[model samples]
Target chain A: MPIACEETGRALTVRVEGEIDHHAARQLMEELSRRLDAALPKSLTLDLGGVAFMDSSGIALVLRAYRRMVALRGSVTLQNVPDQAAKVLKAAGVDRLLPWNE
Target chain B: MKPVNEAKLTFWSRSANEGFARTAAACFAAQLDPTLDEVNDVKTAVSEAVTNCIVHAYPDQLGLIVLRLRLYPDNTLEIVVKDSGVGIPDVDQARTPLWSTGGADRSGMGFTIMESFMDAVKVRSRPGKGTTVTLRRRIARRFPG
Candidate 1:
C-alpha cells in the first residue's frame, strides 16, 4: 500500500492507495500509528478512493485507527470508499461508528 | 469421472496468508465461468478465513496455515483452510455476530461474511487441537438449449 499524509490545522488527511488486505494491513496500521502518534492530529481522515480491493483486515485496520483516535480524544473519518469496500464496512457496522464522506 | 482438480499450499502464519488466499481464489475463478462479482465474493470470503487464522489462531507465534482448493466439474469450488493453533475455546460464541475477542475495532463479522458469500461453510475447532474452515460455492451454470 502507498500512504501519503497532509496536515490541515489539527486534522490529518491520509491518502492510501493499493489493495488493503492482510499483508498490507499491518504495515498500514504501523505507519498510521507512527504518524498519528507524532502529529497528535485532532482528527484523521482516510481517503480510500484509490483502493481497489479490501478484505475484513481492512475493516480491522479502520477500527483500530478509530479506537486510537478516540482514546486520544480525537476522531476518524473515512472518505471515498468504493462500493466494494463500503459493503464490507457496512456489514461490519463500521459506517455507523465512523463518519464517511460518500 | 475424475475427482475435482485439487491444489494445496501451505504458508507461514503471517498476514500474507490473506493475500495468498485472495489471489489464489481469484486466479482459480478466472479459469472458470463465473462473473466478476461472484469471483470477488469467493476471494473475499477466503481472505477473511485466512486472516482469522493469521490473527487469532497463532497470535504472535510462528505456525503454518494449510489451504486446499478443489474445482468440481459441476462448477462448484471448495476451499479448506486449516491451522494448528490454540483452537477456539467456544465455537458457538465465536460464530456470534459482533462477538470479537479483540477490542472494539474488531467487528467479529468474519464468519458472518464467509457464510453469507459462500454457498456452504463448515467450521470445526477443538480447543487444544486446531481449527479448520471449509467453504464452498456453486458456480452459476449457463443454461443450454
Candidate 2:
C-alpha cells in the first residue's frame, strides 16, 4: 500500500492506493500518524479514489483517523470511495460520522 | 478436499492480503444471482474474519494463510479461512465486543463484523494449535425487474 499526502493550506489530503487490510492497516496508520503529527493540518481529507478494496480493517483505520482528527480539533472527509468499500463503510455507520463526496 | 466450484489462494501473512481476500470473495459471490449489496456484505465479512486471523493467529512466525471458498448447490457460499498459528485462548471473550486482549486501540470488532454481515459464522481455535473461521452467506434468487 502507498499513501501520499499533500498539504493544501490547512487541509491535508491523503491519497491511499492499494488494499487496506490488517497487514497494511498498521503501516498506513503509522504513516498517517506521522504525517499528522508533523503537518498538524486543521483538516484531513482522504482520497479513496485509487483504493481498490477495503475491509473491516479499513474501518478501524478510518475510525482511528477520524478520532485523531477530532482530537486535533479538525474534521475528516472521504472522497471517491469505491462502491464495495462504500458498502462496508455505510454498513458500519461510518458515513454518519465522516462526510463523504461520491 | 476438492472444492465444489470453488477457488482458493494463499497469501503472505500481510495486510495487503486482506484486500485480495475481500476482492476474491466479492467476485466469487457475484457468480451467484445476488445483488451488489449481498456481494459486498460477503466480501466485508470474509475480509474481517481473515484479517482477525492475520492479526491474532500468528504473532512471531509468519506462516501461510489459506482461504477456501466453495459455492454450494443451494446458492449458499461458504468460506473457510485457516491459519496454523497461535490460536485464541478463550473463544468466548474473543467474540465479545470491546473485549480486545490487544490493548486499547483494538476494539475486538472482528467477530462482530462477521456476525453482522454474514448469515452464519463459526470460529474454531485451540491455543498453540491453530485457528479456523468459517463464514456462510446465502443468496436468494433475484426476481427480474
Of the candidates shown, which would achieve the greatest DockQ relative to the real structure?
Answer: 1
Model 1, C-alpha of A82: deviation from truth (Å): 2.1
> Model 2 clash pairs?
A23-B15, A24-B15
Two-chain complex of model 1, DockQ on C-alpha atoms against the true structure: 0.46
Tens-digit lDDT track of model 1 for B1-111:
443688888889877667777888778766667887788788889888888888788887978989988888878888999999889998888888778885543558889
**Weakest 10 consecutive residues, lDDT, candidate 2 chain A?**
A51-60
TM-score of candidate 1 against the unseen true structure: 0.85
lDDT of 2 by residue, B44-114 (tens): 78877777776688666577899988998778899999988899989988988646765434546778778
TM-score of each: 0.85, 0.81
Query: In angstroms, how far off is A44's CA in candidate 2?
Result: 1.7
The runs of at least 3 residues in candidate 2 whose Cα sits more than 4 Å from the true structure, single-residue gaps closed, are: B1-16, B23-30, B33-35, B102-107, B142-145
Kindly report the docking quality category of candidate 1: acceptable
> Against the true structure, whose lDDT is highest?
1
